[model samples]
Target: MSDSLSEAWDFLTQAAAEQDDGCRIPGRSWVPPILEDLVLAARNTSLSRYYPFTSHARLRFSTGPESWIGNGDDLAVGIALVPEGRYLVCTQASHDAPVFVRLETADADEAAAMAEHLVNAGS
Candidate 1:
């Protein structure tokens, strides 16, 4: 893992430890919602403003059409293996939640797993 990624992981881990409700770390800032664009992003989100997320595999971010958005649900956030790029570490928030913490890294599984444990432990 890169130094910056390691730094981010440390911060998130500590934050998760501190939270009593849950470790709701912010996800990568989302771009405008568009279908084709999101599809393309699934393939090449690295080329766009999401160059940072391309490193980690555990996290991913997909800005898409309205239909794809979930109204309210408990989406699982955990470790996952992905292609050799960044992934999104987000929550299933409501419509008005603005995206934040555009995390960029290469070690997704490690980061995501740590986050999951932290979140679960916090709650």
Candidate 2:
């Protein structure tokens, strides 16, 4: 970790320690498991529900390049942090052999790109 990152962590720790829980409550942080870059880059990612029962918001890392997991049953999305500072996040309607595309993409538009790469990579 860089000095900046460590400093940021320290600041967050201090703030969290001194903060008051007046209106909203905090939940456990979600950390991903270790995996190869390609494996993580190719996963079906999405904003995991923050708490136990809500879909009101999403985590940005979940929308960028990070590893996420799901049962391939519900609506989903995935993100892969690009080496060049860019990123890729994709979605699929189903988890069948070839995840059906509700959307399509190559690499430019990161807004709503689905898993079009899966056709060549899913094997």
TM-score of each: 0.27, 0.23
Q: If candidate 1 were superposed on the true structure by all CA atoms, what would the RMSD be?
A: 16.8
Global lDDT scores for all candidate models: 0.32, 0.29
Could you tally the backbone clashes for each prediction?
15, 5
What clash count does candidate 2 reach?
Answer: 5
Clashing pairs in 2: 45-77, 45-78, 46-77, 65-80, 65-81
CA RMSD of each candidate after superposition:
16.8, 15.5
Q: Model 2: what TM-score?
A: 0.23
**lDDT leader:** 1
Best by TM-score: 1
Question: lDDT at 116 for candidate 1?
Answer: 48
Candidate 2 error regions (>4 Å): 1-75, 95-123
